[model samples]
Target: MSVRYAIYFAPAKDTPWWDFGAHWLGRDEHDNTALPQPLLDEVSPTELASITQAPQRYGFHATLKAPFRLAAGTDEPGLITGLRTLAQTLKPVALGPMRVATLGNFVALIPHTASADLQALADACVTGLDHFRAPLLAADLQRRRIEQLDERETELLSLYGYPYVLERFRLHLSLSGPVDEAVAQGVTQAVSAHIDRLNTEAPLLLDRLCLFVERNPGTPFQRIIDLRLQA
Candidate 1:
């Protein structure tokens, strides 16, 4: 039997749906749901599913910390307590200007340039959560190699389940599924429209770090913790 585990800041269902529609459109065949038209016009249905499938068919979200398995003896409540303790010392980060771009096969809204505060928050999440992670599995090892992850990246991947962390981490709110080069340009433009609107305002204020978990591989991730950044 598999168990569930993750740490994330889940977007509230009504929080102005953005790029997620493309992913939803791509995934609709498997899990039919409303796709945001504003985004779909930019990419074909085929491309949407393909580009977004790897991360699991879900709506939009900013992954402060990627999900991970629990160590042999760890329990959920203990994990929650640990995260709460960490949140107490940190404050919300002010994201500088951001842009939307296609991250490899996946499409996401990324920082226009780079933001130290954002990197610091990501680092805190990865390091602070280390105590709760389960040991890396063979599959995890294989994935690290496939991604050509560096030492620090491998360490974080082994400890936190995602290769990109800290300085290497780029804040993104995911948009379509994985797509080939053929359709990537259009998807990027569609994503940019939404990103442009947000950029017009002051930099984004990241005040919360949330924990979203899944029971196991096939299940959708859900919110487990909404940790406010401490002052």
Candidate 2:
């Protein structure tokens, strides 16, 4: 199968955080349903859809292990078993308060303070489950634009089939993809205000490994299951 799988950290469904993100992106990956996006004076409904098109496809979540095909000897069941075993050995990590920020040309919600535990969790997901990941194809490497990456990132990509793993990983819940500079500030402010209105007194917790599947190329990924951390 040409299908690909990814491991991500997504807020539980029906929670305030999940609802807000899903509404903002206008799609709920959990059930593959369209949602009513928040209306902003600065951004029209048409413009909002254009900007969020990319993230909407992937849904609202932070990547733990980037998408990859199963290795020759591995199958979907084996991958699920591995994820379940890994989840049992882990404990939830607290991610302190998050703030709206622009990463490169995109906007995302990122932690105000970096969490070592979060990084470790991501590292474990990437390295521990690597045996099931197939090597990246030439098209995959080209799509990643390895030439644009730094030396260390290039090295990491060669080793892990992804450049932004381990040390290079920046945990974020993307809100927009390559925003237009003209309306970037307005979009940022709008998203910030919306997030501020949310009840964020409690720290966000990384409590489960969400399995997302892309059944075909150019298709939106769907949330398959969440394996809770037992520890």
Candidate 3:
């Protein structure tokens, strides 16, 4: 059984970047419109299509905490309470603008630069929520180890179910499925064109973090909680 809990921020539709239609059509990659052109010009069409077809599943939000299975005997309500408690101390991060690009074999929107506020928030979530994460299952450890992850990666995964967290974490909004080098070029071009049209002359702002939870495996992740930044 695989269950996950995540923390992410989302922008509202009233913002200049708002486009419910685009977000709905292309998934959350619509948020990637805020990314720089050079990066957008690097993705493949098939990859972009796959990502957009299921955007909410993959696109547009900075992950505060990566997914992890609930520890033995844990329940959802308790987890929710922990999350809310964490939220109380967190002020909203002001990420003025961000870049969109490929994360290894995947496409996503990320900050053109990093922010200290963002880092602090990520750290808080990981540490505060540590008690909820189960230790890595043998299968998870084996699969990640096969990826030749570094010592830090191994350690983090063992502790948090992901190698990247805290200082190593960067924000991203996913845009495509995994693909080969040949397909990557076209996907980049198509997504670049789309992003160009969406991001004209304004900076993109992240206003809120959304808690998207999957009801079950293979089902679409739905918004279970929406946390706004305290002004």
Best by lDDT: 2
Per-residue lDDT for 104-199 in model 1, tens only?
Answer: 776666667666666777788788888788776777578567467677877767656777776667777676566666677877766666656656
Q: Using Cα atoms with residue i matched to residue i, what is each candidate's TM-score against the true structure? A: 0.79, 0.96, 0.75
CA lDDT of each candidate? 0.63, 0.89, 0.62
lDDT, candidate 2, 1-231, per-residue tens = 689999999999988789888998999898899999988887889999999999999999999999999999999999999999999988998875778888889889988888788888999999999999999999889989988999999998888889999999999999898986766787877877666655365457889999999999989999999999997
Candidate 2 residues lying further than 4 Å off, grouped into runs, are none
For model 3, how does the per-residue alpha-carbon lDDT over 1-231 read when each residue is reduced to its tens digit?
576666766556445454522343344332334322222344444444554554546335567777667888787888887777677777876564544477887666666688888788888778888888787777767766647888787677766777888667877766555656566556556555445555555556554666666656645555567666554
lDDT of 3 at 91: 83
- Model 3's alpha-carbon lDDT is 0.62
When sorted by TM-score, best at the front, the candidate numbers are: 2, 1, 3
The deviation in Å at residue 172 for candidate 3 is 1.2
lDDT of 3 at 182: 60
How does residue 95 of candidate 2 score in lDDT?
A: 74
lDDT measured at residue 230 in model 1 versus the true structure, 0 to 100 = 80
Candidate with maximal TM-score: 2
Q: What order do candidates take by lDDT, descending? A: 2, 1, 3
